[model samples]
Target: MAHVVTAFLRNRGRILLTRRSDAVGTYSGKWAGVSGYVEGDPNDAEDDARRELEEEVGVTEATLANTAQPMHITDGEREWTVHAFMFDVNHRDIAPNEELAAVEWVHAPVICERDTVPELWPTYRRVAPTLETVQTDDAHGSAWVSLRALEVLRDAASDAESWEVLVSFGRSLRDARPSMAAVTNRVNRVLADAAGDTEALCQRAAAEIDAAAEADDVASAEAAQLLRTEGYDHVATLSRSGTVRAALEDAGPSVLVAESRPGLEGVTVAESLAKKGLETTLTTDAALPGLVADGAVDAVLVGADAVLSSGDVVNKVGSYPVALAAARADVPVFAVCARDKIRGDDTVVGEEGGALYDGDLPITVSNPLFELVPSDLADGVVTEEGRLDSDGVERVAAEHAELARWDESTSSGADAGGDG
Candidate 1:
C-alpha cells in the first residue's frame, strides 16, 4: 500500500487545480490537487502535505483549513491511501514544478467537469463546509457563514436533478444560519432570480458568490474612507470579522481588539492585524469597554450578523457593550457590513452556546452567541454604497424583504396545491 497527500490550496472562494504533466509517474495528464507520496510514516501526512504544497506550488505560508479521513483507492493490484488537506492561501502566485503542466483556479463545483484522478470531487467534499458546518460555526462572523452558504448551494446545484430540488436545497442553506441576514438574503436572491431554471440558477449563484465577496471588499473600503474622513486613528472591535480586518488594514488604524470569551476569536484578529504591521492591542472582553471609555479608543467598528429594519444591529455578544462605551465616551460607533446584511424585519434569533464550565455544580450558566445593539448607539452604517442614513437603511431593508418574497410565494403555491 502507498500513502500520499493531496493539498487543495484555496483563495477567495476558489481552489487550485493543476494538470499532471507527462513527467509524473502516475495519473499523468490528469487534473489533480498538489499531490505527492507521503515520506516516512503515515503519521507524517500533515508535514508531507505542507511539503507538497511548497514543493509543487511554492506556497510556503498557506494555512491548513481542514484534513479529511484517509481515502483508500485501488489501481491494478496496488492499494493507495490518500490523505486530503485543504489550505487557505493568501495569494495566487504559482510556480508549478515539473510535475504539473498547467494550473487553474476555479470554483469547487467546476471540478466535477474535469477529467481528474480517482474521486477528486469526493475528496474535496470531505474538506468543504457542509450545512452542519455552517449551522454550528461559532468562530466566524456572518460574512464567512454567508460564503459557506454559497458553497453549499454550489455543491447542491452540481448534483440537484431538478429546479425544485435545487430550490429546496437553497432554502435549506438559507435557514442554516438563522441569525445571519446575509446568508438568507443571498440565497433568496439566487433562488428568486433563477426563476425555476437550474442552469441559470447555478450560474447566477456563482456570480453572486463573487459579488458577495466584492460587496464586503467595497464595504470595507467605504468604512476605511469613513475612518480617514473622521480621522479616527484608533479603533476598537470585538470578535473575528473579515470585513473589519480589511477595513482596519486599508485604513491603517491602530486597533484595540477584545478577546471575545468562549471563543477568543479576537486573539486571531489581533495576531492577524499585528502581522500586517498594524499596532494591535489584545485585551480581555471585560477591559475593552473600559479602554473605550477611558479615551483610548477613537472609534468603535463592528461587523453585523444582521442589520434590522429598525437600524438595530445584531452582532457578536460583546459588541453592544463596546458600542455603549463608545457612545458614553462620545466616540463614533460604526457598524460595517454589506447591504445584504440588513434584514427585512426586526426579528432577532439569539443562539445559545454550551456551558463553558465543566464542573459538577448545578448552577445554571447562560451564554448567548450574539446580542442586539440599538440604532441610536451607532453613528453610521458603512456599506458598499457608503454611509447609510435611516432612510437609506430602510430602503435597503425593503429591498432585502423583496428578495425574500420567493419563499412566501413558494409556500403559498404549496398550500394551494395541497388544498386542491
Candidate 2:
C-alpha cells in the first residue's frame, strides 16, 4: 500500500481538472486533479500538495482551503490511500506539463458528467463543498450537520458490536464539537438508553436522533406562536439560528440584530431578515442595552447552546449582557430552543483561538465562544414543551436526570431516570 496526494485546485466556483497524457506511468488519458505520489514525510500532506500544485500547474499562488480525511482505495493489485485536498487558486490559467494532455477549468457539477479516474468522485464526495461551509461559525448549520452525522453513525452502528462501538461512536460525536450541547445530549441519550439487541438499540438511537432533527422545525413553529401570544411585536436577537429564522417567518415581527462579533453571525441573520422584507435593524452589540432601555425593542430573544440544571443559559458570548440589560430595563428576555438543548448542567466555554487576532501579539487575547446567563435574568425559557420558568427548568432537568450531568465523568451507564 502507498499514499498519494490528490488536490482539487479551484477558483471562481470552478475546479481545474487535467487530462492525463500518455507520458504518465498510469491512468494515462484520464481526467483527474493535480496529484502525485507521496515523496516526503507522509504527515506533511500540505507541503506535498503545494509541491504537486507547483509541479503540475506551474503556479505558486494557491491557498489551501480544506483537506478531507484520507480515503483508502484498492485497485486490483495496488491499494492507495488518497489524501484529498481543496486549494483555492488565485489564478486559474495553468500550463499543463508533459504529464498532462489538457487542463480545463470546469464547474463541480460538470466533473461528474466528464470521464474521470476511478474513486475520484467518491473521494471528492467525502469532502463535498458543503463540508467546508458547515464548518463555518453558523450555529444552526453546525447542529443540523451534527444530527445528520449521528444518524449516519447510528446506521453504521446497527451492524457494529454493542457497548464498545456505541461508546466510541457517542464519544466521537461529542468530541467533534464539545461546545454543542445538542450533539452531546443527543449522543448521551442514545448511550443511556441503549438496550436490547444491537440492531434494535441502533434503530432506537437513529429514531431518537431523527426525531430531534424533526423537532427543530416543530419548535420553531411553537416558539413563533408563543411569541405572537406574548405580544412581542418587535424582537432583538444575537447570532443566527435556523429555529429563530423559522419563528421569525411565522411571527412576522420587526427584528433588531446585534453584529455578533468575531464571527458576525448576527450580520448574516440581519441580512436574511431584511431580504425577507421584515422591518430589520442591524446594530452593534454595544447598542443592544440602549435599544432595550429606550423601548426601541419589545423583547430580547436569543438561542441557547445549553440550558443547565441550575437554570442558566449557555449561549453566544454576548447573550448574557443582552439578557442582563433587558432584565435591568424590565424588558422580557426569552430563550427559544428545542427540548434537545435542555441538557447538561455544566457549561462548556469554548475557546475561540486566534479568531480575534493572528501572529503572537504582545498582549493576551480572550475569545470565549460561549457564556452563561443566570436563568433568573431570563424572563422565560420557551421550548417545544412550552414556556418554563426557573422552577420549571429544574423540573425538566430532573425529568431528564440521565442527561443532567454536572461533570463529564458523572455518567451513570444505562440509567434512564424516567420517561424523559
Best by TM-score: 1
Candidate 1: give its CA RMSD in angstroms. 1.7
Q: Give the distance in Å from residue 342's predicted Cα in candidate 1 to where it truly belongs.
A: 0.7
For residues 11-61, could you state the per-residue lDDT of candidate 2 as single tens digits? 544578889999988889889989889887778877888888888889787
Cα misplacement distance, residue 266 of candidate 1 (Å):
1.0
Q: Compute each candidate's TM-score over C-alphas.
A: 0.95, 0.64
Any residue pairs clashing in model 2, and if so which?
none
Error of 2 at 2 (Å): 25
Tally clashing residue pairs in candidate 2: 0
Work out how many backbone clashes candidate 1 has.
0
Give me the overall lDDT of model 1: 0.89
For candidate 1, write residues 212-303 as lDDT tens digits. 98999999999999999999999999888899899999999999999988788889999999999999999999999999999998889999
